[model samples]
Target: MSDPITPLAKANIPNPKDGEIVAVAEDIWWIKMPLPFRLNHVNLYVLLADDGLTVIDTGIYSDHIAQCWDALLAAPPFTDHPIRRIVVTHYHPDHIGYAHSLSERTGAEVLMSQIEHEKSMALTTLDDVAFADMMIKRYRMFGFDQDILNALAERGNHYSDKMTKTPDAGYIQAGDRLTSLSGDWHIRCDRGHSEHHIGLYDPARRIYLSGDFLLPRITPNIATPLAAAVDDMLGHYFAYLAEMLTWGDDWLVLPGHDWAFHAVSTRAAGLIRHHQQRLAQLLDHADHAPLTVKSAMDALFPMELNEHERYFASGEAHAHLYHLVKQNAMICAPDQHGVDYYELR
Candidate 1:
């Protein structure tokens, strides 16, 4: 079913400058933080509590970001107000960046899903050689060449660069209720973008603070990393999309990136169709001959990619291939050379 039109126009949303807080609702502030990537920025929300402030999603750790947080938190309205807690939507570097540091600084509890917390801790202690070895094997199976394999190995231990410390987080599961200044926020966990991406919804106000699960126009990457090999990532994504379609169309969607939007059910349907098209394209491409994940990745995303981007590219291709196999629409198996290849069933 189609969704109702958004009450607010897209052009009506205010453009927030770096570190500048713009009120989305009563006492709820949206803060955009800068990032050194193609995506450019992340939106962090500050919620006013009776005693202090509750900060959600800390941007990556850096001297510049630190300065911005210091100045913003020390300014009026928040000058004497201490940070009550640090809540993360997921384990991604950008979302959980300064979680550990801020928790230490404010002595505030860090809250997130159990899997996100465990994964964050696991990545910190994960052995570099073992990780590199596993990545090399997976990449090689997906048809990566020797030179690219060496480059992937050199990429080594990426978690340390983005996250400075391990967060000792308190767990918040699906269906849990959190009391905020605005109203009672219910936690809903979805998988596809991450192992356990958390979404906060307030039914009374019809607002959803969607972490990367829902974005304005940009579709969140649906990749399956090694840790999520057993999970049907794309299947989970489609189910979650269907559920979002049932939400009241009037709810304002506060996403992790870009601007806040309202036509959520429309956006959810669009994302469902987007993945369906990608899956169809993969099937058509493989119909010609057995295709490697690398070949499928190139066909689906033709742009030149850096080493880091290549990781996501591989993951995305793997997601489609794995999902097709799960649905019995494609055949995936190893060849004599030990590389995995797919063909239309």
Candidate 2:
């Protein structure tokens, strides 16, 4: 069954019906698609043009989303217009999963950051069993018990499962401007969330298509890569947020997950505060005892999490601890078991 479209245009609809596309402006449209996570949805934008349409951020690959696309393209607004190019903001599974699928359908060019494209390719070649075993070993080093390790191994590589094979992509970078009938969008790239995350801003319209950069309600997950915990991922995130504060507060922020809102500086400041508080929490907990990533995770986020949540939570914990290490507030040294643990300096 096709999902029904609502009559009204939504600058901000908290939750539109599935497969519905609402107008954000005169020509641009917004659609929310289902995601298999706590966040639950990813926002996709369609820029209309007489020549062709430009899609910002493809939703994850799945049967249901495929149906939604079919219904969307077959309808008014989206009908007849070709998807000229797909501008992917990042390489997260939910954002880039269907880039190739839609590109294959519409004969559209896929545009992505070189870093994200390479990361996607590397992730595609990752063997599930090998990935699971490697994660088990790393989680063990982070002080995960055998039970959590077993659950993680069974989970395997969700990214490989969720992400469709990437298509050949044209590279976009900072300072590049994408011109279309709708408007000119300036590209800005930052590090941390994924190696190089892209955000698009339209100066004319004052719209910021912020993908996982500064979410409205929840702070975006700042995670260290599983292979190494030495990188200051959280620090990078803070630096990016600080830079965003200077971008002014008048821009309308269209985030990847949540509802659209204004006040970009306010959102950025709140996110910075959230992480700072988390860092403080971790620092105080470590003062009580030498802590592993697992211990820090429980202290910072003392809530029940399923296997999937655990994976992200572990990285978040390591990111904060390692950021403190970089700040010289903490030190990471291996214990007698060769397990890395954090202690106050």
lDDT of 1 by residue, 157-276 (tens): 676578787688888899998776776888899888888888888898888899898887577877776644556788889989999898846888888988888877888887888889
Which 10-residue span in candidate 2 carries the lowest summed lDDT? Answer: 1-10
Q: Give the TM-score of candidate 2.
A: 0.92
Residue 107 C-alpha lDDT in model 1 = 85
Clashing pairs in 2: none
Model 1's lDDT to the true fold? 0.81
Stretches > 4 Å off in candidate 1: 1-11
The positional error of residue 144 in candidate 2, measured at the CA in angstroms, is 0.4
Model 2, span 1-345: residue lDDT tens? 001111112244345555678877766778888887777888888876667888988888888888888988898566757788898888888899988899999899999999888878877777888788778877887898888888867777777787678778999999998766677889999877877898888999898888888666666788886533357888888889898889777777888876787777776777777778788988888778989999998887788988778878888888888898999999888877757999999
lDDT of predicted model 2? 0.80
Per-model TM against the reference: 0.94, 0.92
